[model samples]
Target: MLNLGTVLAFGALVLFGGWAVAAGVATRSLSAVNAVFLSYVASLTLVGGYVLSVRRPISGTGTDVAFALLSGAFLAIGSISFYAALERGSVAIVSAIAALYFVVPVVVGVLYFEADLSTANVAGIGLAIVAVVLIAS
Candidate 1:
């Protein structure tokens, strides 16, 4: 049996990334604060339905709760800043630069969390940075 979970996740990311760029551009006409609020309201409404439909437990240990809250804070901050950046910068450049954020966690994981780093992983990280720099410049 083919698993649709992974496939759908990737598909959603691509679709939503495109939507984000377009939404940013559309929101560019408004002040960053106004745009962020509007986006948040829309997102919250949509997610409310999603939350209701998705059956999941919220129970977790202190560590897990802390991690979840931290992740949510960073995500909210990142999204708000990204929308603000889109108002002042080209969507292509801003999105490309923001996309490189994964590297931060990779470095953190390797340095503190005992994440295994093979030569290929290191090389890919280096190459990814170069690619983003080239694209941004």
Candidate 2:
């Protein structure tokens, strides 16, 4: 049976794939900066709702909190930059490159965290590289 994490991962894959397409469609007539602005407005509205409904304390060490904040800043920068790329590029190619974002964490995990570089994992990353190359052609 699939675990909750697996189920959630699949759900996210579908949801974000659809979101990417929608983002590209929405960007068709928008300026890159304007697209970023519209997206932030929508995102902030949801963040506000979640903040209002929070019931549990946000628990983390100072270092952990700093890392989280830093990561969030990178996420915003990447998301806004992606929207800018979508405004000027084909969704197919831009999304393919964006999908490779997974590689960063995987590589870092292997190098910094001593995460296992199993054959299967390496092969999967190789396949992803191939997919991106094919998508670009």
Candidate 3:
């Protein structure tokens, strides 16, 4: 039987693949900045409301909120850059480059959270880097 981790990883892959497809479609229909802004607004509205209703108050310090906002700004910039890339390059190429985020998040996870990495994880990251090199070329 498939283990829980395998199932969850598959689910995440499916979700992110779907999101990338949707982002491509949105890029075709709207400006990237607008697309990102609208999507974030709608998602945050629902999620924030649910959190407020079901959980404790968001008691973050001002600095914490500012840092979160800064991170979001970077995300917005990245989305805009991606849309620009899609406009200039083939969707397949752009998508492949964007998928390099998988490797990035793994490195960031290890660095920021001191997450333990298995041999498989390192191999996966190496393969992803190779894929990016091939795709970019």
TM-score to native of every candidate shown: 0.86, 0.92, 0.68
TM-score quality measure for candidate 1: 0.86
Report, for every candidate in turn, its global Cα lDDT versus the true structure: 0.83, 0.90, 0.81
- Runs of candidate 1 with Cα error greater than 4 angstroms are 1-5
Tell me how far the alpha carbon of residue 42 in candidate 3 is from the true structure, in angstroms, after superposition: 2.6
What digit string (tens of lDDT, one per residue) describes model 2 on residues 18-95?
Answer: 879988988989876787778889988998789879866788899999999999899889988899899889999999
**Predicted candidate 3 versus true structure: per-residue lDDT over 76-110, tens digit per residue:** 78877887776567777788888887677677889
Task: Report the C-alpha lDDT of model 1 over 44-136, residue by residue, as the tens digit.
Answer: 899888988897767889999999999988978887788888888888788888888889999899899999999999899899889989999
- Quickly count the clashes in candidate 3: 0
Q: Rank the models by lDDT, top first.
A: 2, 1, 3
Report backbone clashes per prediction. 0, 0, 0
